[model samples]
Target: MDTTTAPDRDDWITTPLTAALLRGALELERTGHGLLPHRLPARARAQCTDPQLAMVESQPSGVRLVFRTRATAVELDTLPTKRNYTGAPPRPDGVYELLVDGRPAGRGSVTGGNTLTIDMETWASDYRPGEPGTVRFDGLPGRAKTVEIWLPHNETTELVALRTDAPVEAVAERGRVWLHHGSSISHGSEAAGPTSIWPALAASLGGVGLVNLGLGGSALLDPFTARAMRDTPADLISVKIGINLVNLDLMRLRAFGPAVHGFLDTIRDGHPATPLLVVSPILCPIHEDTPGPGAPDLEALSTGRVRFVATGDPAERAAGKLTLGVIREELARIVRERAADDPHLHHLDGRELYGPADHERLPLPDNLHPDAATHRLIGERFATAVFGEGGAFAEGGTSSPSAD
Candidate 1:
């Protein structure tokens, strides 16, 4: 802790950070290098073996630095580790969205931090740690205002320090907190920017706070993740299921039903009456009828990109293999059964956000995740379906004891 809020212009005042400003992240650890934010709490993280979960959770997809300041100029030093798949296009610099007074103000980018490159062909990995970089912003309103710096949603960001011309203080938020969990699609897979991700966009449109647990390739309905959701304080909750299960072929229909029940039960243990929405998968033709064990299209990778393909046979569904269509039907049935005694439980067909018709116009570029425009479309649909007037989960809106 620095006692000096010494503000004289050129002297960069170091602002102290607290729990109030950091959103989405579960905990902040002060390391010798800087402050690292973890999406899953220590206990939860300790129970997971999959490295993919570890990566996406720490990426800080919906995390940002929020504070109130009158400084005309500000600088945030951070080290961002961008994920890269071998034989794929290199990702652009992580974007920093600077919002002032709840409005788009400016933007910044930090380059040269670190890269975690994976060779999907060989399942080998390489890590390169780079130097810390700074994202500087100037030309502010020069008046005390709430400012939010949304970090890169697709990269793991380690915040180094905050330097502002004036002292900074955390602002108390005023909105219902929405805790959301889903797969990579919800993790802003192909979204345009950090804030442009569907969840972030929906939160902005719905006038609510978002704690996105959209772990890419990691939303496996793990008990620990459910615990994370249970412990977190939230007024609204949603879990998008299906794609990850189909892609990983983690379990059969018999196991899927019980897992979903257990997931909801754990959350209800902490939040018995919070409005809970269970959403199924959107239209992914490859996985809709076919089972998976999704695999990367080697041909597409040779062209310097990553594309996914369903490898399992549709007929295999007869033997208890999971498919998007199968998961959707099961989720709806489970939600309906549970709602008999739990009036707060609700169900949503993910297709309602992006169905077959929408797929024709806005196709999933990689045949797995929606592209940028689709992200916007899905976000808009979710805002209307869940938060609009008379919507099921809308604040103070009508509550139905059945799936919609």
Candidate 2:
């Protein structure tokens, strides 16, 4: 039998977990139930009835709790909202990773959480609430050290309470905060783990603090999202555009241009000179030329595997519809024109991270998102291109094209 008791404040400092210490999550909502990590703020989430957005925002893909601690054993109470598939293989439990002083330490998972079951054809879902789960890690070095608890990238987490054998304090963040917004790929897609995701990996390699706003299937150029980014405190910012716009068929080229401009304009209103990088979509052959309202490959689905197929016709390009190729060109033009006036803005071709030849070497398993290996590849490539010597975001992030 295990005997554990909550320690007094003097024995363990209990700080109200706030957004300041969280990474990857965009916003934090303090519900009466707990602190819910949200990819979209209350204002943004309130405006949407889309099930996909709701699910994506709630899934704290790269979210984590970091602090300096002297405790050997630590515990956190969390309410995790897990998704349940109707006919697919039983989904695995969301994982929690513990790192001590920048080294891998231990891992755990919370059990008996709420589940949301969705029907593929109807695009409908039913939510069932369950009790919260407690995550515990022990057997660390008894001396003071930095401790990071990585939240599940695929689960919506409501932080309840934190307790440790000894005192814990927020770590003094060392580098600039890198605020990033992107699609499912940035939300971790099918990455092996939360911190192992590309953005997380890149942040680690680049020596930057991370605030990942990677909302899966929901990275459309929404004004609210741009406003959210504008309001957030960040030393550096990046927007990975195109994939969601292409896959959702949400906007044509005509609307996309203004929307991209508007999105950048909103961010600039608050951070006019902050280094902002605009990244176009990586190579996805299906959506390279074919336009989309992408559909699930029914043949693969029947075999308990998920795959995507572009449904829009290539001939629709004349109609101003969007494809990755069209998006890349427009993004380049937007950044070039804007950079003439806004010297702090820069653009990077996403293909530089994952291009055609690289695609041939490491193909996306689902025909959409990158596999675990590809995520690693993208992360390494991004770190080298944007964080290495003389890169776009290299020194202090003041490097942008000279204004015309």
Candidate 3:
């Protein structure tokens, strides 16, 4: 484990956490105690009143603070909102990943902050406030280098202070910006750490900066979300659609097609020619053929393990209910049709990233989200499929592949 200690206050230099020093967040909100990073702008956030959307957008999956300093020791004070299920096992502390000059250097975790407790059976929640905690790292080389502190992907953190042994200056970012939006899976659920999330991992591998707008359980083709994506500047963009819609049973097939079209249309209004890829859902056995309104498996929950089961009937498909299979087919056709006029449009079958074979080796722990190993696999595959040679976002690459 990385070491944490209370260093001499007089020896430390404090820096203000400003927008320039941060990456992958669309907005920074001032709180009573500190600053909080948000993935959606104020306009979009005001359009939705859902608490789940509000919470996940503030999680900061790809948000990190970057600066150049010669400090051997660094400390950041943060107030994190940690979630807990009423009956489920306690979750591990959220990790703060430190990277020096773009290489992993150390990892640390804060001890105390705020807590959000949820009743799994009743779906009610309680919030308890706590004092801020410091995440400290020491024993550096003391040579001038770029430092990046990646915030925890699953926790909503308020940045209170940044203290270093030496003066720090903001470092300007380089490389292409890849903006991606998807469901909870893309939001980094079940991943071990912030940077370990598939999108962050893929961004590093692809040599691109990432702006992840993956709203957990809220990527249901919301107009506000599409508008947010439209306004955010990015060179490469992708939207992973399906799982959330299926699991929530939010819409029927009739609404699904037009919703996707409008979502893409909204994005194109701002980024008319940016390389955009549409990804279908990965191979999820439960929702592949069956429709869903997924429900928690009470039997597994009783055993201190959380699992999900699909509740929608396959017979509902006759009434135009959506399933993963139907979604994949519709997405492919839509991309193909749009690619004819919109040359920059492309599509990638999510199964190519996580198919049956991969699932057999590493099944989803909750029968919904991928495990850590699966996240790495998906990230590697995504980097190759979208950012590799002849891929959609590759330099000089033109024409969208219908399926890859």
Candidate 4:
């Protein structure tokens, strides 16, 4: 376990963290310490200086290292950027999940990494650099097997080193690629671990490879994001829209419709015939009818529990203000109109993934993101809805849904 710096352990084989062994990241940047995975490409990242986008895009939601190894012991050195709120309870260390031949093998966490302290009220942030830490997994079967280490979906990590008792090589790509884009819910906000994130879970169940671009508080239908999706190679694609737009109060209905059309058009430019599914936001009591900009409940924060509330007026809908309800209706219409000519285009009401009944059974702890259990529920439902028989991504299933 202490072998990260133990020079006497000459049997330890160090492997370079190369792109061949990595999956789900659009680009990997050379950092001062090591390699930092980026969900968005350098071009997309340069278009925005928003700190929130910068942070979430680098969180590596569905990023993982896949390799074929006969090693019984593995160690990875990492420098993780952990977040802390000024007035809220500290978050736990992010978990690194290991899978052996596509099954859960082990889980570990690194300690002593960089910290970013954010003031929720002022939206100001401070950073403190720290030393790198090591995560180790031992006692694995010595036989050859495919191994995957899923990075923390909520933390930005820099891969510093990889060492194992035996040499490791990259694994060949497998399964269909499913590229998805959405907000923090799809970003694994409150999920227990990276593998447990809804998209990851759904991909696993659907037997597909996942490339997640679910940036937190940053999925505002940006052109760069749509372009990124456009250029990325994938057999299947889905965009979970509405939540971030409504919560951010980024645009009115007039802008939202055209923006969505433009986003899809850019994607279609690159993948004109790819199966593209447009999904609306799930049921969110706060923003279902009420418009947003969503605000943090300062009162709840005082008790160390983070909560959110919609701040915009429902009456503003007359002014073309967007709400979850309005967004869903618009998304359905757009998909219906587009699908008439594009047989591969389809729409799925997100409520099918998490609806009012499901909400009653398992309310969102923060009035926003789903809890771990709900994430699983959403994932299972998504797998069936999008990848099951007659679903959009199903084999020989090209017919679009009539309504969302």
* Top of the candidates by lDDT: 4
lDDT of 4: 0.93
Judge candidate 3 at residue 97 and give its lDDT.
Answer: 96
Q: Which digits, one per residue and each the tens of the lDDT, describe model 4 over residues 1-404? A: 11233233487899999999999999999999999999999999999999999999999999999999888888999999999998899999999999988999899999889999999999999999999999998778878899999999999999999999888999888778999999999999999999999999999999999999999998899999999999999999999999999989999998999999999999999999999999999999999999999999999999998999999999999999999999999999999998888888999999999999999899999999999999999999999988898899896657556564
Q: What is the C-alpha lDDT of each candidate?
A: 0.88, 0.86, 0.91, 0.93
Order of models, best TM-score first = 4, 3, 1, 2
TM-score of 1: 0.96
Candidate 4 local lDDT, residue 359: 91
Q: If scored against the real structure, what TM-score would every candidate get?
A: 0.96, 0.93, 0.97, 0.97
Poorest stretch of ten by lDDT in candidate 2: 1-10
lDDT per residue as tens, model 2, 194-283: 888999899889988888889899899989899999998898899999999988899888899999999999999999888899999999
Q: What clash count does candidate 1 reach?
A: 0
Displacement of the residue 287 alpha carbon in candidate 2, Å: 0.5
Per-model C-alpha RMSD: 3.3, 3.2, 2.0, 2.4
* Candidate 3 lDDT by residue in tens digits, 195-253: 99999999999999999998899999999989999999899999999999999999999
Considering lDDT, which of the candidate structures 2 and 3 is the better prediction for this target? Answer: 3
Clash numbers, per candidate: 0, 2, 0, 0
Candidate 3: what lDDT? 0.91
Model 4 regions lying over 4 Å from their true place:
1-8
